[model samples]
Target: MPDVLSTWIAQLAAQLGVDPTHVDRTLLLDVARDAAHGVARPAAPLTTFLVGYAAGLRGGGVDAVSSAAAVAQRLAAEQPPKTDDGPSAG
Candidate 1:
């Protein structure tokens, strides 16, 4: 499952004319992150579709796992600011 995500990233990178070798954690999320644009969670659906599309494009095999891993790593690092970090009532 995770491997599929990576393969999709590779395929997407190729489609976008980005050098796969140059892709890093930040770069992956940069690619995967589509700002709200007046809507929330835009990147989620697109990324999900791309994962499946990439696999279909490559005949149902994992090829972009590394790129997906990079994206996931970037996502974790770029996680939104915590909203629950405040003095707790005890």
Candidate 2:
């Protein structure tokens, strides 16, 4: 990871009153990517938000985050591609 990313995570964690060590950036990034591609671009942030909420309910530990992320990723993987309704009006 770049120093800027490390610095940013540390700063964000501090502001959120979370432990940086338990953040697992790589896993979270993977989950975000899965959500964006498998679901929709907008679903990425929503999925991650839900994962974090679930983890917080589970005590906000590393294991909790990992488990929630895994579930979200699995759901993303199983999601079918979105169907097109039709051409949009300008």
Candidate 3:
């Protein structure tokens, strides 16, 4: 993976009080990519932030991360595609 990403994962893991090994990089990246592509590029970081926040609210752990990721994936799938006259264009 890119050095920046690895650094981010390490930092995030440290902040969350978990080992980097416990972080599911693929799952998190997949969710972020889905949010960026399905929703909007600008939504990527916000979506991941919200997912993490939700996970924390649900009691931080593997299960919480999975639950939050699932919710984000579902929302991404349900998002409408962008259009020339879409709200995103305005």
Best by TM-score: 2
The clash count of every prediction, one per candidate, is 5, 0, 0
The global Cα lDDT (0 to 1) of model 2 is: 0.87
For model 3, the run of ten residues with the poorest summed lDDT: 81-90
Could you tell me the C-alpha RMSD of candidate 2 in Å? 4.3
TM-score of each: 0.29, 0.85, 0.78
**Which residue pairs does candidate 1 place in steric collision?**
6-64, 6-65, 6-68, 7-64, 7-65
lDDT of 3 at 86: 39
Query: After superposing candidate 2, which stretches have Cα over 4 Å from the reference?
Result: 82-90
How high a TM-score does candidate 1 get? 0.29
* Candidate 3: segments with Cα more than 4 A from true spot: 1-4, 84-90
Estimate, for each residue in 1-90, the C-alpha lDDT of model 3 and write its tens digit: 669988988987799687787678889889989988888788889988898889889887789999999999998988777775432542
Per-residue CA lDDT of model 1 for 1-90, tens digit only, reads 558767876898899776555545454354455322212346545654564455446553345644454454455355554335422233
lDDT of each: 0.50, 0.87, 0.84
> Which candidate, 2 or 3, would have the higher TM-score against the true structure?
2
Which of candidates 1 and 2 reaches a greater lDDT?
Answer: 2
Better of 1 and 2 by TM-score: 2
